[model samples]
Target chain A: MIAPALHLDGSARYDGTPVFSDLSLRVPAGEWTCLLGPSGVGKSTILRLFAGADTGADFDGSFGADDGAPLDGRMALMAQDDLLLPWLDLRANVAIGARLRGEAPDLARAEATLARVGLAGMETRRPAELSGGQRQRVALARTLMEDRPIVLLDEPFSALDARTRSQMQDLTAETLAARTVLLVTHDPAEAARLGHHILIMGPNSVTPVAPPAGPIPRPVDAADVLGAQADLLRQLRGLPE
Target chain B: MSGWRAGILSALLGVAVWQAVVWATGLPRFILPGPGLVATTIWKSRALIAEHALITMTEVIAGLILGTVLGALSAVGLAASKWARTLVRPMLVFSQAIPVFALAPILTLWFGYGLGSKVVMALIIIYFPVTSSFFDALMRPNRDWIGLARVMGASPARIMWHIRIPAALPGLASGVRLAAVYAPIGAIIGEWVGASKGLGYLMLLANGRAKTDLMFAALIVLAVFTILIHAVVSRIATRLLERY
Candidate 1:
């Protein structure tokens, strides 16, 4: 399948205060694009717009695929919070998207996805029974089960410890390789590690920065990855570079 | 100790204290019958007490089922619509304001001292707690879960049934527990107003005839019945919560 490009142009205001204005960005097909910014710079808001999950935000925008089709039902979002339904077991939670759409949940496929996320034997466990990272992995399994062309992630791994985060990053980079992925995060190192192209979000605009020449997740100790990280830090801190 | 054992132990201790109180006060059986006297009355009048107890049980169980179903539906209606919530919430609160005991006589008069009045009374008593508790819970589903469901294209009705209802069940269970306790009170009050049957009427009749032991026996049976109802309702509620 040919991955569809996403273009979004909008100005958004929350409670009559403008969060961002005249923001425009393009997510190329089948590439991982990381949106790096400080907290509360509306990185997550942008993802919400793409996910069509924006609530109470007055937004004026047009979001469409490269072929000029609306993005509805074509994209799936993994929120900052894992957003696992507490009452559901791991397998049921992974199958919820299908169930919600009035389609019969494929329990077999759900179990397979859970196994892929390394939660093979814990299908019957509730979301509360798992640790934070495990819960996030279950959420990832849910997103993977969605299997949409566009995947929007909002700080999906912020709660994990360093080692687990690295493992998850590798899993995501490999699993979501062919999908158009837009990840929002405040961590420069995470952006350097996972993004094919990193976009530094400012007050009213997003600036694209060229990434190091390698497929992600790149090593944190790689020279080019470290150089990109330093450059991103400078950009975030507004220091002369 | 387990709950059942602890409950039985406490009940025995309570009877011992009661017998001691009767011994120290030197009260006659005509005034304050001792635990042994009450036990004897219970055994001798078992048939009479059981007949009345069964009538009261039927009223309470019928009312519990009807009130729970009606209250749960109302709570769902109120939670789903802004208009219903704005219009009906104050009415629900107002319904509770009219003293329930005062309505007992009116209900008995209207329903003609039959089972109808007692069932209606029990229903009215239980309705408010169930609706208010369940509605409060429905109104405040986990925000993150709701958001995720919305993003996944869940309709409002779907959210209400699949998400809100399941999430709010524990609250509904709590309301049912309160209703279970209150249901017996309603039925007894209605019976006291004008009933020829039920534990309440038996107590009143025994007191009029100076049968203090029989009255005490009926009261004890009623208390035990209430405790049993509460226990059963609690067990069912816990199971429902666990299943969902």
Candidate 2:
């Protein structure tokens, strides 16, 4: 039997302002879930909650991973910021999490992961030495070294040029394989392209975009998902009246 | 113009102005010896002045190493605890307020008339800058850099050894340069109080005997040691901190 990927129920807020409320959702193992919304609509907030950054905040929520354990090595998160250590060269940066885990052959795993993310042969360059696209690729490479069942990406391609961005999206699609991916992307086309299911977040709620016969998928029709997001927004806006 | 050429031209221009002033004013040699006379005296007494200068040099080097280690430890202690920081930092700040002259007497008394007192005085003088610079350096890792390290799952110890210490190298080197310059001067001050032998001792003897040229020559020796120490330290600093 497949374990549940993640479950978020109830509201999460910042300061006193409500961000997401009564927003219960579940992602199954090996499925990609895209959190789609306009800016300031709490898409990023949901990611943070799932990643366990929302500590001591004014919120009422139960976020439980499979097996009832607080999400630990079972999940890996990559923020929009690459956050590479300036002092370390590339290979060491990717190996950091493995080193933290005290795993042997961590450097070898790091190198393999680097190759998986299309960052082959650039292991010795410092963060400053790499281009922005290269840095993000390194970050994505680092994320893969975790080999966790779940992965979170927050606007990972927002900084890349279109060619690099498309390459990254392709790299992400290939590298992630069937991991439970919770992606926060503003690009409707991107959401339509890669998401297994689109969750439109707005009006402080995560409302699933009504699907076709099956889950939304890579090579999906952008117009279809964009129309779904628009309809969801309309439905949410109407509720305020 | 090339930097070296410009430096040479500036030096010549200054010396020419000095010679003109000396000739125009007819100032007594004891009061304001001309650069030429000083140079000649330095060349003539180079061996004697250098012997005493070597003692001063040895004192500076020893004091500098001892001071740096003590200062670095104090910085680590201050950074390690809030109580230490509160107690130690203000005391360090107020330390400068205590006249070095007043403190010199006490340091000499405690350590005594041996070269040990001079070394202690140098350590005291150099300690302030080293501690302050190290404090700034150590605290730097506690900022956004640490955030990156934590997010990458780097343990606190790894962060300190790899990122924090390496990052602080630049500031630490700068502090070392400042301390090196002060080390010799601080030793000389202790020597002035009452030393049997040193460049300072030689200067006192020369002054008492009305050996104006010898006094000027000793001053040149001190200057040479200062420049030599400064150059060596600066070179090491450049090599160590160029990465940062």
Best by lDDT: 1
Across B32-148, the per-residue lDDT of candidate 2 in tens digits comes to 789899899888888888788888888899999999889888877776578998777888898888867677777878888878888888888899999899879888664534544
List where candidate 1 sits over 4 angstroms from the true fold.
Answer: A64-66, A239-241
In Å, residue A140's CA in model 1 sits off its true spot by 1.4
Interface Cα RMSD of candidate 2 = 3.8
Per-residue lDDT of candidate 1, residues B1-244 (tens digit): 5988999999999999999999999988889999999999999999999999999999999999999999999999999999998998898888888999999999988888889999999999999999999999999888777767877778888888788999899889999999999999999999999999999999999999999999999999999999999999999999877887
lDDT of 2: 0.76
Clashing pairs in 1: none
TM-score of chain A of each: 0.95, 0.84
Leading candidate by DockQ:
1
For residue B97, give model 2's deviation from the true position in Å. Answer: 3.3
Q: Choose the strongest candidate by TM-score.
A: 1
Write the residue-wise lDDT of candidate 2 on A137-204 in tens digits: 89888788766778888888887887787777877888787788888987766666677777867766
Interface RMSD of each: 1.6, 3.8
